[model samples]
Target: VNLRSFEQAQLVGSPFIATNEKNMGGLPDRTDDPTEEIIDDLVSGRLPGVLILDPIKAGVVAAETAIKVHPIRKGKSGVPDEQGCIDMAYNCNGCGNCQRNCPNDLDLVEGVRLAKEGDFSVLSDLFDYCLGCARCEVDCMKEVSPLTLLMHAGRERIRNETFNVRVGRGPIQDTEIRNVGAPIVLGEIPGIVAIIGCASYGKEIQELYKMAEEFLIRNYIVVVSGCAAMDIGLVKDDEGKTLYDRYPGDFDRGGLVNVGSCVANPHITGAACKVANIFARRPLRGNFEEIADYILNRVGAVGVAWGAMSQKAASIAAGANGLGIPAVVGPHAAEYRRMFIGRSDDDDTWKVFNARDGTPDQLVGPAPEHLLTTAESIEQAICLVAKLAIRPADNSKGRMIKLSHWIDLERKYKGIDLPNDLEKYIRVEADIPINMKEEVHEYLKQKNWQPRDIVDPTLLKRLCRT
Candidate 1:
């Protein structure tokens, strides 16, 4: 089941039906609070296996379970002091520092001030988007915790009322990508770029559309979920139509696929799994190890959570990395305390199973040095994402496409030369683009680049827990 705005829910369509009848009739103009009605459905077991996308609703369910909450470790910048929002609300000078520094652009100073006057609704949406990054705490001169204030407001708000939404088609089927011949016959289209995560970063939605547009124009498949899809939905073209309204939904080059809400996230990863099972003809039904190894070695896919902010988000990242698909998180993810970083210089770190004998062996470092790493900005992420999409299994065409973009981005943003070992991905002279052939050849010559061939290049892990 889904719970978001009516329009947001309808975009999901089939296989997922809205639980609330009011969704079809449009929201009712009732005096009754919506949250109360939802609680009734959940408690009475009317809605089974409901997926909570809205953080507020998730919090409400947690509260009802009487779970002790620790949003962040104690004594972080944004916890309540001896006196909390009730006492410190008056101290907000309205300098707007909190709002300015907020990645999501929430009007936190105003929300806190209003809460003090007995109104908590002002910040309701903001709390829904908050990642608890505590960037606001660093900006607040008053030492007021916007995180604390938002939580108090959320607790109070949850007790009162909530909004209604719809449940649309759940997630994309892996069979779909198979029909399109993905991973095999992948063409010049390099890989799958899944841009996902929270909207709390306050990034202008247009930036996301442009990002998708860039990759789409370049023939890469772009997929979105949750607020990232919503961000794209918010942008309009010269015709004043959103990408969701304008673009065709397909898992192919220049096609934008919106895989519904956050719960549908697995479908993004599922695409990679399909590449192994369907296209590569690997076993998948229950053999998790073989499938993950195939994906890690063969499929060229990467996930970017540019605004990950919650524990659930962390789990999603962990799960993806565990599957051997590396992910890139936004800088704020540093607060999450865990990022899988691989050092290319440390050959010992590049351990993979040579499926030839199902024995662990040291392989050359993969294109992306890390399974998961944080990017300081979207520009860095765009570059990192392109680089991450390179796989050892890439043909000369795929390698050329990936390397060109990675080289251009590195020059454009970081203004650095390509690392000597980067030539390891260049299997042959034809793999290098004509424009950069000499430069790449020169680099390769210095590194004594040797052509290493894998008779059967499937990666395996010593241990894989389904």
Candidate 2:
């Protein structure tokens, strides 16, 4: 019941694991017990940060947690040495620890008090002001994160009064899937890149937009959701056009699909499943392994969570990997203490089960090379996405298109030096770009490159030739 540990899972699971019993049966039916109450509040929002909320909400430690220099609330005109109150003389009961710990400095305790009295309209402002930083949890004796009080309040208000919530738009439509199916299958487009998660503070907003536009110009299908969906639209050109304003919101080359809040993430990944269903007539019901296999072998999809400060975004990135989609997170992602980076140098690390004979085959290639990895900068992120988008199922033309972007981004960002080990992926002369064909040939000749036969890939032998 420390309640602090729940912070990590808050981002992705809170939606399905909600508070009010009626509102999805309340993940645990959040009772008034201090621990459940704190979890109640925690479930209301999803933001990860360094300053964990004050868990010692019921202890004296709260008094010394913050700067201890703010006006007391109306409940207590606190005197110096007053029990459970700061030294400042004021009418508040709390030590103002929640206020100071809040990144936006909102009155979290007051919100809770208001909810108890059934006047939760005060919490409306918290939605915008609260950046989801769970900093308020420092050392609560009762072990509760004051950060989640907002959620508990929201749930209480809703349990008393009913309101209509809008249904989120989910999944890629059949037509849009059909449209991008050919481009993705044929490799006419590099890959479908989904940029999701919150915007990191102080990071240049335009940097994300530029990365997306880079893929857009290269004709990579870009899908954005959650706060990242909005960040890419904050910057504009001389024409006052943001990426959203300039590009069509479709699932095709040069299209920018903003699929709404984090709840709509299924649409982005759903598009991948839809590809197998719509294009190849693969059944969509309860077929995860085969569908995942199809995506790994053929679908050139990559997820770039450049600012996934929350565990929900981390979960989304993990979910992407579950589907064989390579995920790239920002440099700060290393703090999560988990990653799935492949060793490009170790040949054994690149083995794939060639279902053709239920036998393992060594791929002298980097097909979705690393499942998950950190990117230090935007340039590296761009190059990495393109690099991971490569798969064995890519026809000559498909690999051709993907490699062009990978090589171009490497040269553009890292400077005129071509990407290292470019020979590992090029199976035949046709896989090289038309303009750079000779240069690639020269490079391949020096490395003694030989053409490789494209194999039918399947991790499960059930689908292989008997």
lDDT (CA) for every model shown?
0.66, 0.69
Judge candidate 2 at residue 318 and give its lDDT.
92
> What shift in Å separates residue 446 of candidate 2 from its native position after superposition?
2.9
When superposed on Cα atoms, how far off is each prediction in RMSD? 11.8, 12.7
Best by TM-score: 2
lDDT of 1 by residue, 1-466 (tens): 2234333322322111233443433432222336555445444435422434455664565455222222212223323533566677777888888888886787887788886776767876576667667778777888776777787666654455332112224555666766655433332577778878775534534556766776776667888888777767655678876666655677777678887788889987887887777787877788888777777766777888766556666678789887778888877678889988877776666655554566556364565567899888777887788888877666677678878877877787777888445765676776787788778888898888777544235554443322
What TM-score, over all chains together, does every model reach? 0.65, 0.67
Model 2 TM-score relative to the real fold: 0.67
Candidate 2 accuracy as lDDT: 0.69
What does the lDDT read for residue 310 in candidate 2? 73
Model 2 lDDT, residue 72, Cα: 20
Off by over 4 Å in 2: 1-169, 202-204, 351-364
